[model samples]
Structures are given as C-alpha cells and as structure tokens.
Target: MGYYQIDCFKIHLTILRILGVWPTENPSPCYIYLSGLFVFIFTVLYVVIYTMNFYFLPQQLEIFAEELIFYFTNVGALSKALAFIFLRDKVKKMLEMLESDMFQSDNPEEIKLIQKAKEKSSFYWKITAGLSVSANTVNVFLPFVVHVVFNVKLEFPVCRYSFIPEQYEAIFLYPAYLYQSIGITSHMLYNVNIDTFLLGVMFLAMAQLDILDRKLRKVTDVCVHTNAPSGSIDKMIDDENAVAEIIKCIKHYDAVSEYCKLIQEAFSEILFVLFSSGSCKICMCLFRFTMPAETKYFVFLTLYTVVMTLQVMVPCWFGSRLIEKSSQITFSVYDCDWTPRCRRFKSNLRLLVERANRPITIRGGKMFLLSLATFTAIMNSSYSFFTLLRHMQSR
Candidate 1:
C-alpha cells in the first residue's frame, strides 16, 4: 500500500476545510472570509463572550463549573483549530513526508501492517465523530424537547449571552439558540476530527515501526543452494542482497523518526494545551457531583469526563507505544543472524543500534514525555484541584 494508505484521512481533512480552519497557501477570498467568520465566532462569541458571562455570574460553584466546562472545551477546540491554521506549512510538510516512499514498502507483510493501522484509524474516526456529534445533538435538541413535551422553560445549550438583558431573552432565545446549536455542532466535529487525526498520525507512525522491526528480523535472511555446504552459512550471514535489504530498513527507521519529529513540531503547542488544560477540564467535570443527585446533567458530565480523559489518555498511550516500538528496533537487529555479517553491514547496523539506544521520545510541547506516567500526573493534578474545590465549598 502507498505510504500505509494514510490518504484515508482525506475525508476528515475536507471536513476541516468546510469548517473553515484548514490552511491554504492562498485561499480564495470567499474561503478567507469564511475563515475569518469562524475566527470571529470562536474568539468573540465563545471565548470572549463566555468569559465575560462567567465573570458576571455570581460565585456559585454550579455556575462557575457549568460555564467553565463549556469555556474550557471551547478553548481546546479553538486552540487546536488556530494551531492548525498557523502551522499550515509544517502540516503540509508532514503530509508530504507521510506519503513519501520512506514510509512505503513492497513486502506483503509490511503492507498488511499498514492496512491494519489505517483500518484502526478509520474505526476511531468513526467512533469519535459519531459520539461527539451525538452528544452535541442531545445537548442542543433535548432542551427543546423538554420545553415542548413537558412545558419546562427552554434553555440555550450554551452561554446565554448574559450581555442581553433577561427581560428580552424571549425575543432572542430562538435565534440565539439557533446560533448555539450551529456553532457548537461545528466546534464538536472539529474537536473530534482534529484529535483523532493527530492520534491517527501517531498510530500510523507506530505501525511503520512495527514494519521496521520485522524488516530488521529478516535483514540477514539468505537463500542457499541445496548442495551448499553447511559451513557456507557463515558466508551467507549478510549477503550483498541482505545488505541492501538492511539499508532499506535503516532508511525506514529514519523516516519514521523524521515523521515523529514533524509531528512534534506541528503539534507541540496543541499537545501542551491538551495536557495542561486537561486537569482543569477534568476538575470542572467532577464538579458535576455538586449538582442535584438525580440530575440528568450529572450523566452528561460523566460522559464528558470520559471523553476528556480519553482525549488526554489516548495521546499518552500512543506516545508510549511509539517510544516502545521504536526503541525495540535495536533488539530486532540483534535477533537477526548478524554476528557473521560483513564489515560494512555490521558497521551500519552498529550505527543504527547506537542511535536507537536512545529511545525516540515524543515530548508534549517539549515539556512532559507523552506516556502513561504523564497521563497519571495529569489525572492526579485534576483530582487535587477537585479536592481543593471541595474544601473551599465546605468552608
């Protein structure tokens, strides 16, 4: 398959384009205007408007938590969307690298590995997108259902534009609510799409590593004549053909390393915001417990907490796997029949092993390493914040 067939992400990238955040070198005026509109919506409406609303709200834990959840969630989406826009050139380079021959292979086994990784990525995209859109649909429409069927007062699924005097809320509620539904739906899709796309890149990178390991294991394989002496096995340890194969594998490893470096460069800020803000988001999610025990909002918050946790945890998990898989290449080389190999091959292999000795670490924004330990630290910080909030409430 071509570069592990990562073109499967084309559809999602197109979605981002429609969402007006996809970067273009010279977008048409219409597209530029569309992009500007989203920028205004995210900055002026969500972040700026919501923050002002939060500040004016009374110091109740429920109000702050509710507003904070939406605000923080919006921040995640906005930051990632903006990062993608500004880092467009880096993203283009990364995609070019992904599609380069360095990540491609003719071997059936390696092709299968690529296929599996692509399938897994597509599966995640479906699940995450479906869940995200479904959750947003419920948030927007469920309130209207309550108003219609049970005569409960209607509410906006987002900030109520506290700047608008409540006396006239009735006049604007319908149109304002319409804007909320559309804006939030767009934001939700962007959130899931960008996240899955990032993680999918990492997943595919790990798959390349898997193929690299397998190639290393077979790097010394050689064919021998049936009449050849058993002693000839030593000479065949690394034939010229085997040397060529090992070189290709070495290049594959290098490509994967470079691919990861590009990912780090493109997503450094995005990952930083994810891990750093994850705790506060989780803390706000936890504050849902402060709501009435029988409240349905509790269930929503519970699910939201899970989504946020997965958002942080999945990156760390993939990152740890990337480090593990890349590091194991050295051992794979050792496992092959390389002891009696030629001097040139041995020297090259030795250099590769030396480089692999230091496991490739994908740091989150040049800060914490993206591993389970980092995930745990983030969760701990979230719990600490939650605990501190509880104590404050008790006082």
Candidate 2:
C-alpha cells in the first residue's frame, strides 16, 4: 500500500513539474526559490487569462456562459493547488498516521481485511485517474477535430479569450492552442489528484471501521458463553480470560476512534471546498448542456457533468459506509450472550455499547456531515440553481 501511494504521489509530482509547480517532499533553498517563482508565474497567467475571458470578454450570452463554467472550474483547480501547497505538512502527517495505525495487527483476519482495503483503494484510484486522463485528452483534441472536419475557422481560441491582439492572431494561433492545452491539462490533473487523494483517505477510514467491527464481533463471540460449568474454579478462570479479551478490544476501538479523528482533521477543509465548488460546477454543466451548442461541445459538457457527479458521489458513498460500520458495533455487542455474564462484565459491555452508539462521521469543514443525505442535498440545490438560471435567461 505504501509503495502504491508513493507511485501515485510521484505521478502527481510529475504533472506538477510539467506545469512548473513542483512540490518536493524535502524543500531546499534552491527548490523553494524556483518553486515560488514558478507558482507565481503560472498562477498569475492562469488567473489573468481566465478572469478576462469570464468578466471582460465582449461576447454573446452563450459564449460568456460557457466561459463562466470554465472559470469556476479553473478556480476549483487553483483552490486544490493552493490547498496542496499550504496543507502539505498536514497531508503528510495524515498519511504517516494512516500507515502506522492500520496494518499493525498480527491477526490473520485483520491482515486480510487490510489487504482487501488496499486492493479496493488502488482499483478506485486507477479508474478515476483513467477517466480524468481520457476526458482531458478528448477536450484538448476536440477543437482541432471540429475545425478540420467542418472547415470552419474559429473566431476565438478554443477557450474563448479576449486579451490576444487580432494583429498577432495568425502568428500566435498555434502557440495559443498549445498554451491552452497545457493549462487545461494541468488544471484537470491537479483537481483529479487532490479529489482522488481525499477519496483514498476516506476509504482508509472506512477500512479502519471495518476492522473495528470485525474485532468487536470476535471479542463478543469469545467472551460470551451460552453454557457454564458447575465448578467455581473453572468459571472464574473463564471469566478472567473473557475480561482480558474485552480489555484488548476496548484498546483497539480507542485506536480506531483516534484514527478517525485524525482523518477528519486532515481533510475537512478540502472536503468543504470540493463539495461547495462541485455543486456549482454540476449546476453550470447541466445548464450548459441544456443550452444549444456545437455537437462536440455538448459531448464534452456531458462527460464533464458525469465526472463532477461521480466526484461528489464517491466520497458520500464511503462516508455513508463509515457511518453504517461504526453503528454496527453496538448491535454486535448486543448479539453477544450477555445473560450469564457477571455484573461487572455486563457493566463493561454496557459502557462499550454506549461508546459505540455514537456513530462516526466525516464532516465538511466542521460544518455538515458528509453522507448520502448530503449528496442528495447538493443535487437538489444544483437543480434549483439550474432552474433559476433557465428562468432568468428566458426573461
């Protein structure tokens, strides 16, 4: 799992280097100096170009609307880049803690569970990365394809910017295309990297909850005896072992709780920004889809909308799983044969049940819980915004 994570991080760094925004694990004086200069130049160019297209362009409503969607999308990507830069230490700490806390158990069942989690996480990461790359490739090449097939010259660059002088258009046309291609690809990769990394973290939390559930069930099974021997000596020894097992389970549960807290702290801000921007992106994409556009443009919008929906759904799905698994602990305790246990043992069980009753949750900036419910709310809000936009345009 560590190797896989490192490989993914390397891919992220490669993309950043291509964008001239390299972020090394160990920052030397030279690295810092160079990285700062690169980030400043890249960010300034991105913001100025997109901002001009969005706010200053003298274009039709349809054209401006399309540029607005791209503007917000790029803003989201920039937000991710800024977050990666500022929260590098926190992200590093979270990854270290995840490695140390999980995969430490010697129990065969626990080890198996962890392995399954790693496999699942890797699968998800690969699928998302593939989809992002494919979509970006299509977006980059579609303009050229349309231009060639239809033999119609585009009035503006593919991204519809207004800052370039008309006198320089012939000279800078191909150069501008190359620049936009690199800029758009970098934005897509950066956004996907941060989003999928957060998803991996959420999956880790879900895996920890799974381990805790299994451990609790096993402890309950071992400690709860349906039948007892008549001799006091034998029963006393049995009770002592049961108590020891329960104590061990208690420690394991505590560890899982602490791990969940660490995850929440590490990702709350990122999640908040993702969910917030994701809502607007979805709404805008849907609105653009409704508006009459070129065939290729419509296809791109459709794919973009699907990706945005998936981004929101993946986290909510894992978050909902976390809640379900955490809640199961109390029920597992209840399933144990607690009728014949001693008074002290029952009291301990009761306390464990109480603790487990508090369902674990992942929050967005400490604001709202991330769950299927939240996903539903985002969809509803997006539809409402889309309706309002349509009505205003009609008027």
Candidate 3:
C-alpha cells in the first residue's frame, strides 16, 4: 500500500476499531447524520469561544507583542555594537592615514601614528567579530520562547473544561488555538531571518573595510617617504607649504572615503528595501486587523516604542558612520609627504582633498534619508491608529 493509504488504514482499523467507530462498510445514513451534526456543533462552539476570547481577553495577545518587541530591539542594538567592534581596526587605520601628513611625510612619528591606529582598530575589530556571531544566534532563537508561550495559551484553557458547558467547545477548542499559534510561530521565524540578514551584511561591511583600509595604508606608506621616481624626477612638482602638500595628496584619501561611504549607503538601502517588502506588509496588516481593539491599541503602543528606539538608533548610527568616514579622509592626507618641491603635485592633490571631503556630504544625505523614513513610519502609524478607531466606533 502507499504510505498515506497505510497510515489511513492504521488510524481507522487500529485506533478507531479500538474506540468502536471503525466502519466495516460504508457508514449508515444514521451514522452520517450524527457525524455531520457533531461537526456542525463543534464548528459553532469553536467560533463562539474564539470570538469571545479574542474580543474580551486582549491581554494575551498584547503579551506576545511585548515579548517580540523586547527581543528584536535588543538584537538590533547588540548586532550594531558588535559590528562596530569588528570594524575597529579599519577605523583606526583610516584615522591614522588622515593624520599622516600632520608632520613631515618622511618623519617616523607620522608612520608610528599610522601603525598605532591600525593596531588599535584591528584589536577591537577582532573582539567585535567574535561577539557578532554569538549575538546573531541569540537574536534568531529569542522569539521561539514567546512562540511557545502563545502556543500553550492557544492549546490549553485558562478556565476549567467543566466551565465550558457546550460539547462543541470541548471538541473544536484547540484548532482555533492552532491557527493563531501557527501565525505567531511564522512571525518569529521571519524575525530570525531579518536579524540574520542584518548581521550578515554587517560582517561583509567589516571585511570590506579591512581590505580597503589595508590597500590605502600601503599606498600611504609609500607616499610617506621622500623618494621620487628617478630619471623623470625633475618633472615631478614639490612644495613645503602644508596646505599645498595637502592639496597634492588629497586624491588617495578621497578614494578611501568614497569607497567606505559607498558600502554604507548600499547597506542602508538594502535594509530599507528588506523591511518594506511584500511579506512584511502582509504580516503587519494581519497583525493589526486580526486583533481586538485593546490589543490593537497595545500594538500601536509597541510601534511607538519601536519608533522611539529607532530615533535614538538612527541618529547614533549616522553620527558614527559620518565620523568614521571623515577620519579616513584625515588619515589619508596625513600620510602624504609634504615637501618643498611638491607644489605641482599639491595642485593635482586638490581634487583628491575635495573628494575626501565628500563623505561629510554623504553623511548629511543619510540623515536626510533617515528623517524621511521616520516621517513615513509615523504617518503609517497614525493612519493605522485612526482607521482602527473608526472601525471600533462603527461597530
């Protein structure tokens, strides 16, 4: 027999036979009638119990939202912190490069500062890397605990079974619970993927920053010394004024700043896309519409909490990225050897210096984007709240 057929036979012949309901032939008309009646009664009981419980005891649903909000917020914070730590070395090296030209490019002090910054950023980056994987795992699993709690409430009654006088309530009660339980579990899984994606992107950012910083450092190290290309050395411009030297060496630093900003902007854009897509929208709609009034209110409250958290989070994140990008520019310029004959080179370097300054503008752009996103989120929240209120009033 096929597996499904064998499973059906086993359930009917063994379990149903033991209970004395196994059919030897087609069920009689009386048996079919009774079965239909029982199913109908069970359906009625299920609907009544589910509707009553949902409309009355919204606290149960509120508890689930509260747990989810807490878990997700903490995960976001920890992931961000760990990501910062993992990129620390790159940040330090970039900073050193920016300050490299503060003294004579050929000076040992300038090289030493660069070296120290690289070492510091590297150590922190390693430490943060170790923490990020663990934090991500925790973020993925934390919501399962809440899922289990909701599932239990769905399956088990808070009151005594005897208190429910209807036979249908006893028969169909758990299935209604199963539906919401499944929804809760699905949402938790979705949250896990979101956290994992964020962490994965952060890991990539850390790795790319390391590679970029290493390349820039090598180039800066070469520029730190006074040896010009021979044979055509006379063709090369040289100058002593720090500003002129700065203008000359700005190109390489500008490249570093641009590369870093490019990575950050790309990552942010991906995050926004991921959060606003189809599945998130559908899930959010169900979460709002399926719950009763008080539960819906609590959902709005949770949204408010997320808003406040994001307000703090977005600004801090933008500030850190801005400062880091600016530091990379500073270190790149600092690595240049500003000498008396480098005047023409300095003029060519002006373009690069200007490029290095571009990240500050990019940083400002991010702040503007974040402000727009925040406004959108607020508008959505207000619309949802008012619509829900109108729904209640009409009812």
Query: For every model in order, what is the number of clashing pairs?
Result: 0, 0, 33
Top candidate (TM-score): 1
Task: Assess each prediction's global lDDT (C-alpha) against the native.
Answer: 0.81, 0.72, 0.39
**Candidate 1, lDDT over the whole model:** 0.81
**Order of candidates by TM-score, top first?**
1, 2, 3
- Tell me the tens digit of each residue's lDDT in model 3 across 1-395: 12211121232133222222233346678765664453233333433444354333334543443333333333333233233234434433432333343211343544454344344444433443344334433433343455566653333312222234466774756553444333223233323332333333233333333333443344333343245564343324323333443433344344444444543553353343323331233233335445566764566556544544443344335435544655475355445443333445555555555654544422222433333344455446545754664576469
Ranking by lDDT: 1, 2, 3
- lDDT winner between candidates 1 and 3: 1
Pull out the clashing pairs in model 1. Answer: none
Residue 393, model 3, lDDT: 44
Better of 1 and 3 by TM-score: 1
Residue 190 lDDT, candidate 3, scale 0-100: 28
Give the RMSD in angstroms, all C-alphas superposed, for model 1. 2.7
Comparing 2 and 3 by lDDT, which wins?
2
lDDT accuracy of residue 103 in candidate 3: 17
- Per-residue C-alpha lDDT of model 1 across residues 129-172, encoded as one tens digit per residue: 88877778788998888889999988888885767787988899
Global fold similarity of model 1 (TM-score): 0.92
